[model samples]
Target: MSLIARTGPQEYECRVGVLDSLTEKLRVRGITKVLIIHGTDSWDKAKNYLTQLMDSDITLEFALFNGECTHEEVDRIVGLISQTQAEAVIGVGGGKLMDAVKFAADKSSGVESVLIPTLASNCAPWTPLSVMYTAEGVCLGFVIHTKQVNLLVIEPNLLLDAPVDYFVAGIADTLAKWYESDVVLSRPEYQTNALLLLSRAAALNCRDSIVNYGLQAVKDIQNQTLTPAFIQVSETIIAVSGLVGGLGDGYSRSTVAHAVHDKLTAFPETHTFLHGEKVGYGIMVQLAIEENWAEIDRLAVFYESLNLPKTLADLNLSDLTEEQLGEVAAKVAVDPILLQSQYRVSKEVIQGGMRSLENYLATTV
Candidate 1:
């Protein structure tokens, strides 16, 4: 029998003022010299908290991320680690920077890594995978590492400073965990799988938590108050959402939703939209493909409240001709991940779903 790897972060802490304890956390793990990879803007905001670490005995170095998590960037960071002889890497920024640091640390043998998300954008910090993109910002693929993060520190205070849009996008992305995974796990063949059972519970938690508390969470984020609702929703996004993928393994991996997001990346016009925004629309498309109109209507209402993308126009693909959409459909249909769905998907089906979603949106509006 093949061995299944069920691993998560060695240590996970979510609380206010957790950033102050970062250096000591590393020290306890015997991590001495550390390389910190962060975004320019995020670093500017976090410098004050980071200053506290300098007082500790741990040696530190800094690397500025260029906004894309490409293989080249990972290699460059790995090179820096080699030269500096950094024992560990601390990623203190958003999803892209965290992914870059994670990939680099995984590639560099014997080096451990920690993630401190400056924005609750995606579950890049907790998962053992990096969503790779081209330098030009096109989605290439994702790389699965052999291990989960060494530590995940989520300081609610730090997250509160992030733009409200990031939190909304995160909600949309986390919600996809349920819509995307539920269809596959509901299949009879996989019902007995223990991992899928755990994954289903996690996915449900993501959906329910967001549905019950997401609106209030967004409000709290706008007010810069870390209320109970906000904390619950944020953890649902970062921690519980990661568990959906971690426990489910390949069976619960994203299906049509992420496939559409990947194909949408090929268009520069769609670049302005966040990852979750595109996936939010992709969820509608997936529902359309399944002929689940009621669920689509329910989600459309929720997405409208959150300002998530609901139509091609919302994704900045309003002017796209049928031929252009067909090109995107072709890509999505061919993606290997789409096959993970319990039902077969085709280019024609994707195109039809796009039309159906557009029609539904038109009538509703």
Candidate 2:
């Protein structure tokens, strides 16, 4: 019999003050010695809560994250974990740090990992994949590990302290889960796959939650008040959005939107944009490629509402000549991941889509 392995974190906890109980959680997991891999800024913000862990019997060590989730960094941390003989790895910070720790722990057998995210920026903590990047911050691709995370702890109050842009970027990223996957799921060959059906429902749920509660959630964040709406949206971003990929498997993989984001990373100027912001514009390009003008209009209104990128100008690529933009389209057309789409995509198609989007934006403005 063929066996299918489904992976997820062994334990997950989300609450307002969960950080204060990190020691007890580790104790229950029988992790007596741990090495913490975290970003410098996040470590500073979380020092107060982290200090209490040291008061317990658990042996703790800290390593400042060097900032990217590259193979070299993973290898370096793997060496540190071996030298420290840590029973477990505690990744405390944003997505990149969590990815590094997860990749390192997965690469080194017998090493367990616990993720504590300081922002609700992406589903990196809940997912089993690490997005590997070049040392220069260019996207190489992602790596899927055989094992899932040991534990995931999310403190909502800690997330509240992150910049508003991170939260907005997260919303944009989560919304793409629906748009990107629904197109693939609608294909005839995938229509009856039970797992994909569940994933489709999850993606729909993500969309509904964001559509119904996103604005209020943004308002709550601006006001610095954690309301029911804010909490729901945060969980939707981190948890519900993750379930889409977790259940969908390969069939639900991101299509054109993320592929465009990866290609845009080739330009240093686009590096200033957040991951989700780039994906936001990518969604627009994908819609244009499908020739879905009405849907594009609706999404454009929503993008404006959330200050998401709706045009090339918003993506900081408006200054590029048509030839330069064509080069980007050619690169995106050839991305191996984008080729997995059920529909046939080509350089000419992507370039045409970009031109159409630009013309549409000009008329609307």
Candidate 3:
């Protein structure tokens, strides 16, 4: 038996003016009627690039993505798809919008999905999974779907206008591909698994590309410039990062870093933090658990340069009660995703990791 990797969408394209072909592309796929689910702000920005879809004879029904990939949102999208008899569903926005459409389309008898990401925030546009959340924005894990997206097209112009904070958060999120996967992939037993090896290579690319070009990419986004570094970093975040989990499956899927992020979401104070920002802090915690101080030191410099969260204070958890901190550590210690790594961490160890990271950061200063 061989490993089956759902690496990305069936048809993926990234370039300037790509959405200009949106109508013809859908038409060729036998998709005439579509339910376009989008965020208010992102859809407004994406509208300029989708002139073809608007002018074409295709029947279009528009629905607003309610800012979360909650079950209610997915159900609403699915209901719209059924009522409109849409042949396809197009998602135009950030990760949550795309995830809602993807999951809704799958539930709606596997209707074709076309994703247009307005923000280079995460791999939701590329991966065959949806990171589900509550209506209140708490993490509820994720669900891997049976079908891949029918099409995913990225227009650099649209992403160039995205908020720089999301771009930086995307970089931090993409960097986790390396930190999360290497823990398990570097083991001896999986040495000969070719697909996992490919995943390992992709994970390394995600790390190196982001580290080398992330700052410049942030600057490019800030200046609204479509430079080579911007394109490379954006694609690395959206496409290359997908390969880490797609190719390796559970082995390279989120480990401790993401589990930490998930746990932190339970705190209301951390609600203001972006997904990747918390994961950035989680990376330091994961390193502390492994007692890998050298790598932690290396990453701390990068974290500081990007204004990524490296300590509890950075995540606004500096004043968290001892009981509250213990609760978080206990929850994270038992997270199912944490088992993916070779580590066997306990609640005390998790708490110690947090303290060690804070102590280490203090020493660095």
Candidate 4:
């Protein structure tokens, strides 16, 4: 049998003030000598919550990163962990910081880490994979070091301070979970209870929050009010995106959506667009290719109405030539997941979809 079964730990605690009981949990798991990995943010906003969790004897160290998870940042964090002989890592910040901890802790002498998410941007906390980058912003490998997560500590009050755009993008990312998964999981060899559970949940709730909340979710962000819909979106990103998306056993996400995003990223003009925004557009493009016209048009209105990028210009890439898009398509061709998985996704087909998306976006606005 595999060393780590594709299952969560026997016990998990997803709660507010998770840190108040954290010391006991760590002691229960035999974890000591914790490292706090932080990103650039307002510590004051979360100071009280963290202070309550700190035990008198727990040795703490700070490993800092600016906004990005660069190679240098990882090195600094890892260097600190290596020098300190810490037993576990506690990542505190938004998704990027959590992702960095996930990447570094596994490589730091096999120490497990706890993810304390301060914002519900994406489900980076729940996943075993870390999306890493070079110092120069080149996309590197999706670091899949540890298949285990020790804890996910979330306090809704802490999230009330977050910028609503993070939550909005998070919802967009989760929406793709169901749509992309539906295509990928249909492959006979890879479908499973876990994948079905995740994809179905994601699909069902894709539009529910927005439909129910309307502009209230956005207003909640403006007012810093944690509405019921906001909580659902946050939970989806932190819980479903990380755990469910990570545990999609043998399932493929190499669908038309992500492929189109990959191709779009080839051009520098589209670089400023947020990850979720790109994926949202990608999902629309994928639906168009799959000829799910009903869903595609509906999604198009939502994406456009929200001032999200529907065409290249919206991504600030109105001037990109077709050659740049082709280059992106070629670069996307390199991911091994495209060919090695149970589902068959052709490079040519993906390129065609990208071209179709580009054409559609050109005419969309």
Q: Summarize candidate 4's per-residue lDDT along 1-365 as a digit string, tens digits.
A: 11122444324555556667777767787776888876666455766777745745667776665666766777778888888888888888887777788777777777878877777777777777677765545556466655567776777767767766676676677667667666765655445555555554554454465445635666676787767866666776667555444455435333545555655655566667666778777777667557676776677777755666665566787676667655665665655444433335455655576567667656754
Write down the TM-score of every candidate: 0.97, 0.95, 0.97, 0.86
Error of 1 at 54 (Å): 1.6
Q: Tens digits of per-residue lDDT for model 2 on 18-119?
A: 878888888887889899898877777866667778788888888989999999999999999999999899999988888999999998879998998888
lDDT of 3 by residue, 80-149 (tens): 9999999999999999888998998889884899999999988999999999899888998888898999
lDDT of each: 0.87, 0.85, 0.89, 0.65
Best-to-worst ranking by lDDT:
3, 1, 2, 4
Model 3 alpha-carbon drift over 4 Å, by segment? 1-4, 340-343
Report the error of model 2 at residue 153, Å. 0.6
lDDT of 3: 0.89
Q: Name the candidate, 1 or 4, with the larger lDDT value.
A: 1
Q: Report the number of clashing residue pairs per model.
A: 0, 0, 0, 0
Score candidate 1 by TM-score against the native. Answer: 0.97
Candidate maximizing lDDT = 3
